[model samples]
Target chain A: MELILSIAIGTLTASGVWLLLRPRTFQVIIGLSLLSYAVNLFIFGMGRLRMDAAPILEGAGSDPANYADPVPQALVLTAIVIGFAMTALFLVVLLAARGLTGTDHVDGRER
Target chain B: MGALFDHLIAVPILLPLLAGALMVIVDDRRRPFKIAVNLVSTLTLLIVAITLLMIAGGMTASGDPARTSVYLLGNWPAPFAITLVLDRLSALMLVLTSVLAVAALIFSLARWHRAGPHFHTLFQFLLVGINGAFLTGDLFNLFVFFEVMLAASYGLVLHGSGTARVRAGLHYIAINLSASLLFLIGVALIYGVTGTLNMADLAARVGDASAENRVILEAGAAILGIAFLVKSGMWPLGFWLPTAYTAAAAPVAAIFAIMSKVGVYVVLRLSLLVFGPEAGDSAGFGAHWILVGGMVTIGFGMIGVLASQGLSRIAGYSVLVSSGTLLAVIGYGTAPVISGALYYLVSSTLTISAFFLLIELVERARDAGADVLAVTMEAFGEDEAEDAEEEVGVTIPFTLAVLGASFAGIALLLAGLPPLSGFLAKFAMIHGMFNPTGLGDGLPIGAGTWVLVALLIVSGLAALIAMTRSGISIFWASIERTVPSVRVIEVLPVLGLLGLCLAMTLQGGAVIRYMDETAASLSEPAGYIESVLTAERVARAPSGTPDPAQGADEETEVAP
Candidate 1:
């Protein structure tokens, strides 16, 4: 499970960084989305890749070892919400830049 | 009164938040009403900030130098809860942010607020974010506040939308978005290694981490430092700052003067609190890189200042110089030097912000064509005829005179010349470097110290030269320019900010003493950790076991 997740994260980050370096605004936005996806997964993995464990306490005095740590899941949830908002904001800004500058290039000018 | 004071730490975050939400519901067409709401909220924030400062200062002066007032959100226990810790440093930053907000909001009243939709709302939300970032003691909460701040900043930067603003805003958002991703990864890595997100608890656990865990922790810290360095406008990572800042509207640009400092503040806080001497294996981790990066940033800023053509761009580069100085000084890592850096932070922020405000007014006198023509004439040595034809002893308009005087004051302050807070800040810093322990005798001054001193002096000289050149072209050579119709409201904020710098110069001793104590408290993290981790949850009535669902609802009710 760890191996699969790590490889997934690495591929997503590598692709995201490559696309981020592209000059087009749309590509950059997509790149940011990919990067955020990778980050979300990474944060999720921080809880140590638990399977078949309750995320919350079953009852008082229950063994915590049988429960998955919920903090990283909560963190990932917040990161996803923030990431969604940021991507939305970036899309609007990208559209605005394209409309105002008459170019989709990141620099807002043709080479 | 005492109970109210306990919750004062939360007010700075909540007040602006409520105001922003309220403004969102108000009709944007009711501009005056919206302005009134913003003004009231900002003024109240200033009052709260000042009261907090006084409380913090009083605490520092009394028995406990490192005493902190912690407010637990949702009445949760310290490590499990989001806490707001108000010590001398956070209080000082809160006051600074409020002061700048007041000036910027007042200045925006002239014209910029009407340039875009939802300006007042965005402004209020920005304050909420900045205040929250300063007050929150949890890392995750800090990230949330940072996002809030950045989100609002994006809207404000693109507020008065133009091709320039949109283009600059594109780069700004992309860079910051990437930085935010880095922040998340770094934070998660640290959490995976340490099992805690509360800063004080993290600090405690960091000291006892195994060697392998220490390596991961340090790596996390370094990544986190990079994220902050990007925000702080450190060398290489901060190339986006000048263009974006120059493109922002005047008031927006002015408020952004504190934005970079947020990064610096976090760096200072974490370096001292988490990785200070108590952290066994990782003591002083990454200090060398910070020092070297800061010096290079100073060099870069000096060149950028010299090369910048527009006054606003120079102001932007000046922000870099200010950030570089503070970072370098903080990296030096002595109590007295850190105190001086704190003073420098205040003085430089005020001066740079005032300069940003002054640039718009000053640029008003010369039209765009004339600005280009003047630069061309100077470049081609064709200004002699204009100089010869200029009339002698032309009476300067009162507005022009005031603008020119303020321009000179900003120049002197930026250049670290005598009789201004800038010079005094540098003087205090140098004095501290010479006497690190307040004793006449200390370790011999090192070569790195000499290099930093030289850089500070040279950076000041570069600023003086750049300002003089820009001033001559705008005020001296542009004699044929019409005086821009200036409003009293517009000019007052600029003068007020400059006057505050002058006040800082006059009250140097008291301010320095305050900074000295603040730095002393920062150098010792034991009290900070003790106060934070030991803060008990609020006591409740003894009853039968409550429903978990009801308990969750109660937590939400107690929030704010």
Candidate 2:
């Protein structure tokens, strides 16, 4: 389980870094999104792969039933929402830049 | 009673939140509405002061023979839901932040019209983030608050129209946005492993991690540290700060004071709660690199301060250097070191912001028409450049005096001079690092001690030279224009800020004592985790939405 997760993480990270290093603003934004996805999944995996166990605790069934940890999931859900807002904000800024200044070099201006 | 107290915990966050909404509604440029904003800001400052006083007073009887106070939010308890967590350290930061906010707002009223778009509104929103960041006990909320401030700040940093401001502002936004993303990633990893976002709770859960898990935790920790280091202007990570800060308007730069502390606050919280001695004892590790990073930061900042020609930029470099000193001390893994770091943070934040405002005043004076003040007198009454509140077109004479005084105080404090709290704080840190019983075992205590001492001396010498250069450039070196003056609304805030900085200096003993108790509280990770996690953990499990604990466990999966 860890091995597959690692490979996925590695692939995502490499691709994201490449995009981030690109010269276009759109590519940078895409890179950031991909990177965030990798980070999110990697973080999720850290809870240690427990499949088929609902996190819900049974009251009378048993004292020590197997269950998934849900804290990271809840937190990551919040993060995903926030990340969307930010990426959208950046995207809008990117569009605004294209409209106002006529260039979308990753640097955003004549540096 | 408890509910009432919890609601009281909401005041700092609530004040700015309501004010931001109100400013957007008020929407007009009338003085009355502005006054209303100022009044609310003043009241907010008072509320912050009250909170700090309450915490300080409570600390006198706390676990330390000194003092302590921690406020959990929403009756949600300490480690579970988002806690206000107002121990002495946070309370102190809160007081400084509010005071600076009020002062800056006061300075902005007449200046607001000059500021272009929705100036007061963005200012209020920025405060919302700062107050939230200082008072929050949850890491996720911290990120949320950070973005809020950064977003508002983007508008404000570019408030007045100019190509330079626009360019500077974009770089600023990009860097902070990147930092914010890193902040989330780090938090996500921590939650996965520890299965909790509650800071106090994370501390408790992380202590017993397996070696492999610890490695994953450390990776998350280091990444998070990198994000904050950028904020604090750490060597490589902070390359963008001096330019961004130096380019902003005086009042705008004044608020940037709170920005650096956000990173320091995270480090302090992580050190005290998540990475305390217990974490070290259990995992056979200590935060050694924090010290090394801090030392390098100070060295780099000093060199930058010397190299920079402009007054505001030099002040900006000083902010970076002081942040480095604080980071290094925190890394020392000694209680006293943390306390010293806290004092340095407070003093440096105040000093650098003062320099920013005064530098603007100086630059404005240079740009002024013939009608302003007498050239030589306004140019550099070295002494009056800071203290006086009366200016022809000049910022207040009293303010100028206070600014000058605070600038001097930075040198005194940053250099760890006698009769200032900075010296006492450094003394405590050094004592702990060198003393056997304090650091006590295979930790490279002797080497760390000498390195820290060297940092102190080098930073001190650099400050001495940097300050003198700033003093001359900001006030003297005739810049071929009439004098700069202050608007009626601006005086009290800058003057008020200088006065508060002085008060802290005067009350140095009390300040350190408060930090001592808070540091002790922070050192005890057991209580923080025990406070937030288990109770919430148990209650949430029954709901079946899957407890966030799984996410916390993910933090562990990344461990090795």
CA RMSD for every model? Answer: 6.5, 7.8
What lDDT score belongs to each candidate, Candidate 1 first? 0.89, 0.68
Per-prediction TM-score, please? 0.93, 0.81
Every candidate's DockQ is 0.63, 0.24
Best by DockQ: 1
**Model 1 C-alpha lDDT per residue in residues B1-560, reported as the tens digit of each score:** 35777888899999999999999999877988999999999999999999888887784234433358888987778898589999899999999999999999988886567667899999999999999999999899999999999999999998867677889998999999999999999999899999999999998888899988888889999998999999999998999999999988889999999999999999999999998899898988888888888999999999999999989889999999999999998898889999999999999999999999988888766677345334423543343455443323233359888999999999999999999999999998888888887767867999999999999999999999999999998888856668876777788899999999999999999999999999999999988999999996656647875644458767756665
Which parts of model 2 have CA positions greater than 4 angstroms off?
A: A1-10, A43-70, A92-103, A106-111, B1-3, B28-35, B59-79, B112-114, B280-286, B367-447, B526-560
Pick by TM-score: which candidate is best? Answer: 1
For model 1, what is the alpha-carbon lDDT of residue B560?
A: 55
Cα distance off (Å), candidate 1, residue B233: 0.6
Per-residue lDDT of model 2, residues B373-447, tens digit only: 233233323434443443345345554455556567656655667665556656666665666355455556476
- For residues A26-76, could you state the per-residue lDDT of candidate 1 as single tens digits? 999989999999999999998898889979674456799999999999999
DockQ category of candidate 2? acceptable
How good is the docking of model 1, by CAPRI class? medium
